[model samples]
Each structure stands twice: as structure tokens, then as C-alpha cells.
Target: MQRYFVQESHWQENKVTITEEDAHHIKKVMRMTEGDSLIAVHPEGKAYKVSIESVGESIICVVREEITDNKELPQQVTVVQAIGKADKVEWVIQKATELGVSRIIPFQATRSVAKWDHKKQDKKVARFEKIAKEAAEQSERVKVPHVHRVLSLQEVIEETKDYDFRVFAYENEVRNGANRKLSEHIKEMTPGTEVCVIIGPEGGFSPEEADELYQSGFTSVRLGKRILRMETAPLYFLSALSYEWEE
Candidate 1:
């Protein structure tokens, strides 16, 4: 069954009014009509089995049954990724959301080459947000992962001080044959603990940046023996986390 997310304002009594883009998707694209059943995710992440009550200019769905199931990681994992060139950031956001990350933070590392113009940051973030929402719905996630505003390395470090666990994927660590792995730290984490992992851009992080992160309680870890791209490393780490934590 298809799933659509609706705002709180759309809810009235037992029915939801779907308008704008979602209405177009149902009426024209999917061609779904009255009596069709679909899952509607509320703003608070509750899922309800809804039967299409009516469809025309808007989609009106009557709530049939409430779904108690939730597909999300027990731990809230935040991926702090350095802005990369091209559409790599979008690819990262889409794949990471599917892999069950709770939040994503784009960082401006010392060696990061792709710089977002201050004027267009909001627009770019909005695009990433849309990608995340669609990916979450397709992956059956209850809550959509949030795309945080881009921050400088110092700002990122300051913000992550409250996180329970932090690690940075440093290519140099793999080169040095560090035996420590992210799983080692993950295994020690309790449920509901927040984990943040940092990944560098195309040029990777500078030595000073790595040192600062390490000094601020981030474990310098390697994803694998082989080097992965800026976009691929975070996904790999998230997959490893899922393999370890998910039942």
C-alpha cells in the first residue's frame, strides 16, 4: 500500500484532507480512487490505515485503524557530513534516511570544497528535506529524518558536545591500520543514546580538524580497510550500525 504524510491541520475528526502535491499524486499520478486503502503518516509519526472516502480536487481519507508499528533505529544517529561537490549531498541524504539515520548535519570542514552560498542555503536544505521525506516514506520509516542547517566545523563541534557517542571517519586512520572500529563504540551504547559520526568531503578533513574532533571526545575510527567516498562512508557506517543494533 502507498503511504502519504499529512499535516495536523489536515486532520478533522476521523478523516484527513490531502491537498496540493499529495492530492495531485493520488488523483493524477497513482490514479487511486475512493475505497482504496493506504497508510497515512501523521505529523507526530503515527500511521493509520485510511480508506479513500472521496477524491476530486482533494483526497479525503477516513481513518480505518491505527498502526502501532515503527521502523526506526533504537539509537538516534546523526551523520555530520561535509558538503561535497555536485549532487553527492543529495545522494547521501536519500540513502542515509533509508538506512535509518535520525538526523543529518552538513558541516563545512576545513578542506571542504563545495561551499553553499548563504543566499541559497534555505533552498538547498528544503530540497534535501523533500528527498528525505520521500525516502523515509518509501522505506516505511515512521518519522522523516531532518536535514539540519549547514554549520562550520567549530559550530558542529560545539553542538555535538551533548551527544552520548561521537566518532569521525578519518581516512588516515585506515592508512595507519587502526584496529578500532565503530562497532566497538556502538556496542557500548544503551538504547536512546545519541550517536554522531563525521565524514569529510572530497578532499577529506585536515589534520588539525581531526585533532580538534578527537580532543573533543570523538573517536577516530576507520569504516574499513578500503577508502570509501565522502558519500559512501556514512552509508557504510549506518549499515554497520543497523547490523549490530537491529534485532
Candidate 2:
């Protein structure tokens, strides 16, 4: 069944209204008819098996039953990713959503090369959000991960107050032979814990930024013996998290 993250307003009682792109996808792309069933997710993260009732300007789906299977991670994992090339960031958002990230924050590291234009920030974030939503649907996720506006290192440090656990990927840990393993840290986290992980840009974080993060209660952890690319690091962490928690 196709999955859609329907807006709160689009859902009325047991009926779901899908419009625009989704409607086109159903009517044209999927060639789904009135009887076809799909999964419609509520804004609050509930999902229902809905069968199409009417198809026209807007597709109306009647609720069949609520889907009880939860695909979200037991803990909320938020990735604070430094802005890199546009395509790399998009890839992280897409794959991270599939791997069960609860939120993604784009950070501006000292060595970040791709900068976001303040005027186009909303547009850029919107595009990233769309990518997350599509990935969520593809992954059969009940909740779509959020993509926050770009934040500077200082801003991210201040926002760390909300997380229960914090860590950052530092290559120095590997080079210095620091026995920091993500699995060791995962053992300390309880269910419902909120974690924030920081990934550096292509050029990596400056020593000053890393120091600030460490001082701000962010533990330095190594993904493995080898260093990972900016985009690959988060996915590696998320995969490890899912393995430890879900598998």
C-alpha cells in the first residue's frame, strides 16, 4: 500500500483528503482507483489503512483500520549535520529518514563551504523537507522526520539543552586511538531518550568548534577506525542505532 503523510486539516473524522501531487500520483502514476487501499498517516503520528472512496479534484480515502505497527526508533535521534554540497545533504536526509532519524538539523561549521542564503533559507529547507517526506513514505514510516533551519555552532550548542544524550563525530578520536565506540554509548541510553549527534562538513570541524562541542557536553565518538564522509557519518550512526535498538 502507498503511504502518505497527510496534513491534520486534510483528515476529518475517519476520512482523509489527499490533494495536488499525491492526487496526481494516485490518479495517474499509480493508476489507483476508488477501491485501492493506502496508508494515511496523521500529523500526530497515527496511521490508518484507508481505501479510496472518491477520486477527482481531491482523493478521498475512508478509514479501514488503524495500523498499529510502529516503525519509529524507541529513542529520538536528531542529527546536527554541517552544511556540505546540496546533493550530499539531500542524500543524508533521505537515507537518515529511512534509518529512523527523528529530526535533522543543518549546522554551519567553521569549515563549511556551502553556505545558505538567508533569503532562500525557507525555500531550501522546504526542499529538504520534501525529500524527508518522500523518504518517510517510501520507508513506511508513521512520522516524518523534521528538518530544522541552518544553525551555527553556537546556536547548536545552546539548543543542546533539550537533548538527553549528545555526541559528535570526531576523526581525532580514531587518530588518537581513543577507544570511543558508539555501541558503548548506546548501552547508556534508555528508551524514549532524545539524542543529538553532530556531523562535520567535508573539511571537518575546526579544533575550536570541536572544543566548544566537547565543553557543551557533547561526547566525542568515532564511527569506526576509519573516518567517514560528511554525509556517510550520520547514516552509519543511525544504522548502528537501529541495529542496537531494533534488531
Candidate 3:
């Protein structure tokens, strides 16, 4: 069944109002009509199985069934991903959302090649957010994951200060037994605790950036023997978190 997300205000008595892009998508794109059955997510609550009762300037779906169940990953995994080339970052957002990451933070690292101007950054992040939301719904996630505005290394260092568990994937830390530490770190995550993970850029993090993150309370750990690409790191991290918490 088709799944829709609507604001709580859309619900009044026995009907729900859907407008703007969603209404257009249903009326024009999908060509759904009255009596069509589909699933939906309420703005402030859970998913529902609804049947379309009206289709006009505004579409209304009557609540046939509502599901309060949540299918989010076991932990609150926040990926502080380095802002890379355009398409690469978008891929990260989509994949991360599908993997059940709770939040995504785009940042600039020392080796980052692309820089976003104010206007471009706004447009870019908005696009990624749309991608994230669609991916979330497709994955049957209870809540949509957020894609935050772009930040710099300094900003990320300060932003993650309040996170309960902070980690960074660094090859340098391997000499310090980074792999062993990653294994041990997995055993320590609390079920619902917020974890902040810092992933490097295309060319990877500079020594200075890595060191600064470490000083900011982010534990530098290794993903494995082979270096994962900038886009691949977050998926691996979220998968590991899922395995640790869910499996």
C-alpha cells in the first residue's frame, strides 16, 4: 500500500486533509481517487492504514487503521559526515536514512574538496532532506530522519560535545589498537543512547582534524583493514550499531 505522511492538523474528527505537494502527488502523479486504500503517517504520531474518501483541491483519507508501532534502529546513531562532492552526499543521506540512522550532520573536514556557498548549501541540503524523507518512508521507518545544515570541522567539534557517545573512524588510531577499541566500543552502547560518529572526507581527515576531534571527546576507531569510502563509512557504522543493538 502507498504510505503518506501528514501533519496532525490535517486530522479533524473522522478525516485528514493533505495538501500542497502530497495532494498533487496523489491527485496528479499517482492518480489515486476516492476509496483508494493506502497507508499513512500522522504528523505527530504513528503510521496508519487509510482509505481515500475525497480527492479534490485537497485530499482526505479516512483512518481505517493506525499503527503506533516504531521500527527505528535500536540506537540513536548520528552520523557527522563530511560534506563531499554533490552526488556523493545525496547518496549518503539516502542510504543512511534507509539504514535507520536517526540523524545526519554534514560537515567540512580538512581534506574536503567541495565547498558550498550559502545559497547552494541551502538548496543542496533541502534536496538531501527530501531524499532522506522518501527513503525513510520506503524503509517503513516510524519517524523521518533529519539532515542538518552543513557545518565545519570546528562547528562539528563543538556540536558533538553534548553527545553521550562520540566516535571517529581514523586509520592513525590503528597503531593504538583502533580495531580492538571498536570491538570494545560496540559492547558499551546503551540501547537508546545517542552516538555521534565523525566520518572523514574524500581524501580523508588530516592529522590536525583527527587530533582535534579526538581532543573534543570523539574516540578515533577503525572500520576495518580496508578503508571505506567517504559515503561507505556511515553505512558500515550504522550497520555495526544495528548489529550490536538489534542482533
Candidate 4:
């Protein structure tokens, strides 16, 4: 079923009113007419099987049934990803959501290549959020992983201090030619703990910045001897976390 997120206020007594964009999409683009079936997700975590009863500036409908989502992971993994160009960042957001990431933080790393001023930053953030929402729907994610506004490296490190555990993907820090697999660390993580993973930008995190993160209680973990691209690292981490956390 096609799913659209709706605010809790829009649903009342088995009736749902779709507003703004959703209303337009159903009426104009999809050309859905009366009695059409679709799924509406309420902000309070209820999924409704809805039938279109009316359409106007906004859509009004009656709920045919209610569904409860129970596929969410026990642990929430938030990835503080370094800022990258448009395409790579979109890839990270999509794949990370598919792998069950809880949240995503795009930040400025020591070696980041994407430059943004306040005006441009807001636009970028909005675009990123759209990507996240679409990805969540495609992947059947109960909750869309939030795309947090961009932050500088120091700000990100400071902001993440209160997380239960923090890990940083460091390509250059692997020991003695041994492949540092994520599975090695997954066995130690307990369920329901919030884990934060940081993936640096192209050229990777500088040694100085890595040191500061280490001091801030983030353990630098090596993904492997062969460094993965910035866009690929978070997906790798989230996948490994999913396997361990779910199994």
C-alpha cells in the first residue's frame, strides 16, 4: 500500500484529513478518486487503511482499519556523517535508512568538501530531509531517520557526548594489516543502547580532529584495511549493527 505520513491532528475518530502536499499528490498527480485505497501514517504511530471519501483543497477520508508498526529496532543508531557533495550525501541518507538507522547528522569534517553559507545551508537541509522521507517510505521504515542540520566537527563532537556509545570510522588507524571488521565490535553492544557513528568526508578525518573526538569519548574503529568511500561507510556500519542488533 502507498504510505503517507500525516499529523496526529489530521486523524480523529476513524476519520483522516490529508492536507497540503498529500492532498495535491492524491488529487492532481496520482489522480486518485473517490473510494481509492491508501495507507496513512499518523504522527502518533498509527497506520490507517483509508478510503478517499472527499477531496478539495485538502483530502478527507474514513479509516477502514488501523495497523500497528512493530518492526523498529530496539537500539537507535545515529550516524553523524561528514558533509559531502549532493549525490554522495543522498546515497548515504537512502541506504542508511534502508539499513534501519535511527537518525542522521550531516556535519562538517576537517576534510569536508561541501561549502555552505546560512542561506544555502537551509536549502540543502530541506532537500536532504525530503530525501530521508522518501527513503523511509520506500524502505517501509516505521520512522523516518531525521536529517539533522549540518554542524561543524567540534560542534558535532560536543553534541554527541551524551550518547551511550560513540564510534568513529578511521581508515588510517587499523592495526598491523589486520582487517578491522565491524562484527568484532558488534558482539559487545547491548540492546536499547543509543549508538552514534561518525563517518568523515573525503580524504577522511584529520589526525588532530580524530584526537579531539577520542578525547570526547568516541572510540575510533577501523572498518577495514581498504578504506570505503565516505558515502559507503555509514551503510556498512548500519548494516552490521542491524545484523547484530536483530540477530
Candidate 5:
């Protein structure tokens, strides 16, 4: 069944009102009519089987049942990705959502190639969020992962204070033949732990930036012996996490 994330105000009792883009998708794209069934995810992450009661300017659905399956990762994982090329960031947002990331934070690293225009940051963040929503629905995620506005590396470090564990992918580790894999660090994580994983840009982080992050308590972990691209690093980390916790 198709899935749509419904806002809290749009829901009343067992009925849900889906409007705007999702309504268009149901009416034009899916051509769904009355009595057609789809899943409606609540803002708080609850999902329900909903049957279309009416389809017109808006889609009105009646709750059939609450879906109990949890598709989220055992622990919350936030990807702090340094802004890279536009396409690469979009790919990360899509794939990371499918991989069950809880949130994405794009930051401006010392070596970031793509710089965010402060005036247009909201538009860029909105676009990233749309990609996340589409990916979440396709992956059958109960909730869409949030995409934060671009932050400075220092701001990101301050934000990590709330996370239970924090790690950054460092290619230097691979160069130094650091044997500690991401798996080693993540083994210390338990269910519901909040984790933050940082990925550098294409040019990678400068030595000074790495030193600062290390001082701020972000453990440097090697993805493997090989160095992954900026966009690939987060996916690798998320996959390893899924293997350890889900599989």
C-alpha cells in the first residue's frame, strides 16, 4: 500500500485529511479513488492503514488499523555531512533515509567545496527535506528524517554534546593502518542510543579541523582500509550499524 505522512491537525479521531502535494499524488499520480487503502503515518511516527472515504480537492481517509511494525533503526543516527556538490548531497539524503538515519546535518567544513548561501539556505534545506520525505515513504519508514540547515563545524561540535556517542570518518586512520573499525566503536552502543557520525567533504577536513573535532570528543573511526567518498561514508556507517543492530 502507498504511504503518506499526515500532519497532526489533518487528523481527527479515525479520519485523516491529506491535502496539497500528497492529495495531487493520490488523485493524479496514483489515481486512487474511494475505498482504496493506503498507509497514513502520523507526525509522531505512528502508522495506520487508511481507506479512502472520498477523493476530490483533498483526500479523506478513515483509519482501518494501526500498523505495529517498526522500521526504524534500534538507535538514532545523525549524519553530519559537510556540504559537497549539490548532487552528492541529494544522493546522501535519499540513500541515508532509506538506510534508516534519524536525522541529517549538513555543515560547512574547512575544506567544503560547496558553500551555502545564507539567504538561500532555507530553500536548500527544504529541498533536502523533500528528498528525505520521498525516500522515507519509499522505504516504508514511519517518519521522515529531518534535514538541518547548514552549520559551522563548531556549531556541529556543540550539538554533539547531546548525543550519546559521536564518531567521524577519518581517512587518515586508514593511512595510519588504524585497525579500529566503525564496528568496534558502535559495539558500545545500545538500543535507543543517539549517535552522531560526521563525514567530510570531497577535499576532506584539514588537519586543524580534525584536531578540533578530536578535542571535542568525536572518536575518529576508519570505515575500512579503503577511503570512501564523502557521500559513500555515511551509507557505509549506517549499513554497518544495521548489520550489527538489526541483522
Candidate 6:
């Protein structure tokens, strides 16, 4: 069944009124008519099986059943990923959502090659947000992950100060043959805890930036033996977390 995230105002008295882009998708793209069934996710993450009641200017659907499936991870993992070249950030947002990330923070690191103009930051963030929403629906995730506006490395460190745990995916740590794997650090985190994992860009973090992050209480950990690309590192961490936590 097709899925949509609807606002609370759109839902009332066991009926959901789909409008705007989603309504167009139903009417034109899917060609769904009366009695057709689809899943409508509530703003708070609850999902329901809804049957089309009417279709015209807006698609109206009546709740058929409430879905009880829980597709979220036990713990929330926020990926503080440095801005990379091209659409690599978009690629990261899509795949990270599939792997059950809770939030994505695009960081402008000292060594980051790609830079977003201040004027276009809103559009850039909005684009990533849209990608996350679509990916969430495709992956059957109960909740869509948030995409924060691009932040500087210093801003990211301060923003993540309140998280239950914080760690950086350091390639240098791997080179030094650090005995501590990301899994080891994650194992110490209890279920329901929130984690922030920082992954640098293609050129990676500068020595001073790494030192500052460590000083800011972020643990520097190695992913594995081999080094992964900027876009690939976060997925590796998320996959490891899923393996560790998922039943």
C-alpha cells in the first residue's frame, strides 16, 4: 500500500483528508479512487490503513485499521556528516534514513570541499528533508528523521552537547590501530539513549578540529580495519548499530 505523512488538521474523526502534493500523487500519479487502500502516517508516527472515501479536489480517506508495526531503532543515532561534493549528501540522507537514523546534521568542516551559500542553505536543508521523508515512507519507518540546517564544526559540537553520547568516526584512529571499535563505544550506550556520530568529509578533519572535538567530550572511535569513503562511513556505523541493537 502507498504511504503518506499527513498533518493533524488533515485527520479528524477517523478520516484523513489528503491535500497538496500527496493529493496530486494520489489523483494523478497513483490514480487511486474510492475504496482504494493506503497507509497514512500521523504526525506523531502512528500509521493507519485508510480506505479512500472520496476523490476530487482532495482525497479523503477513512481509517480502516491502525498499524502496530514498529520500524524505528531502539536507540536514536544522529549522524553529524561533513558536507561533501555533488549529491553525496543526498545519497547519505536517503540511505541513512533506510538504516533508521534519527537525525542528520550536515557539518561544514575545516577540510570540507563543498560549501553551501548562506542564501541557499534553506533550500539545501529543505531538499535533504524531502529526501528523508520519501526515504522514510519507502523504508516503512514510523518516524522521519530530521535534517538540520548545515552547521559549522564548532556549532555542531555545541549543538550536540546535550546528547547522551557523542563519537567521531576518525580515520586516524583506524590508522593508529585503536583497539576501540565504534561497536564498543555503542555497547556502553543503553537502549533509548541518543548518540551523535560525526563523520568527516572526503579530505577528513584537520588535526586541530579533531583535538577540539575530543576536548568537547566526543569520543574518537574507529569504524573497522579499512577506511571507508566520506559517504560510506556513516552507513557502516549505522549498519553496525542495527546489527548490535535490532532483534
Best by TM-score: 5
Instruction: Report lDDT per candidate.
Output: 0.90, 0.92, 0.82, 0.81, 0.93, 0.91
lDDT of 6 by residue, 34-112 (tens): 9999999999999999999999899999999999999898888899999987499999999999999999999889889
RMSD of 5: 0.7
- The lowest-lDDT stretch of 10 consecutive residues in candidate 5 is 179-188
lDDT of 5 by residue, 1-247 (tens): 8999988999999899999999999999999999999999999999999999999899999999999999999999999999988999999999999999999999999888887789998899999999999999999999899999999999999987889999889989999999776777889889999999999988878999999989998888999888899999999999999999999
Ranking by lDDT: 5, 2, 6, 1, 3, 4
Over 4 Å off in model 1, which ranges? none
Kindly report which residue stretches of model 6 are placed more than 4 angstroms away from their true locations once superposed: none
Instruction: Report the number of the highest-lDDT candidate.
Output: 5
lDDT of model number 2 = 0.92
lDDT of 1 by residue, 1-247 (tens): 7888888999998999999998999888889999999899998989999999999899999999999987888889999999987499999999999999999999888888887897999999999999999998899888899899999888998988999988889999889998877678778876799999999988888989988988888888888899999999999988988888886
Off by over 4 Å in 4: 175-180
For candidate 2, the 10 contiguous residues with the lowest summed lDDT are 173-182
Q: How high a TM-score does candidate 5 get? A: 0.99
TM-score of each: 0.97, 0.98, 0.93, 0.91, 0.99, 0.97
- Could you tell me the lDDT of residue 236 within candidate 1? 97
lDDT (Cα, 0-100) at 137 in candidate 6: 90
How well is each residue in 1-247 modelled by candidate 2, as lDDT tens digits? Answer: 8998889999888889999999999999999998999999999999999999999989999999999999999999999999988999999999999999999999888899987788999999999999999999999999999999999889988887778999999989988888757799988777799999999988888999988888888899989989899999999999888889889
Where model 3 places Cα greater than 4 Å from the true spot, the runs are 174-181
lDDT of 3 by residue, 116-148 (tens): 786787788788888987898788886778888
In model 2, the clashing pairs are none
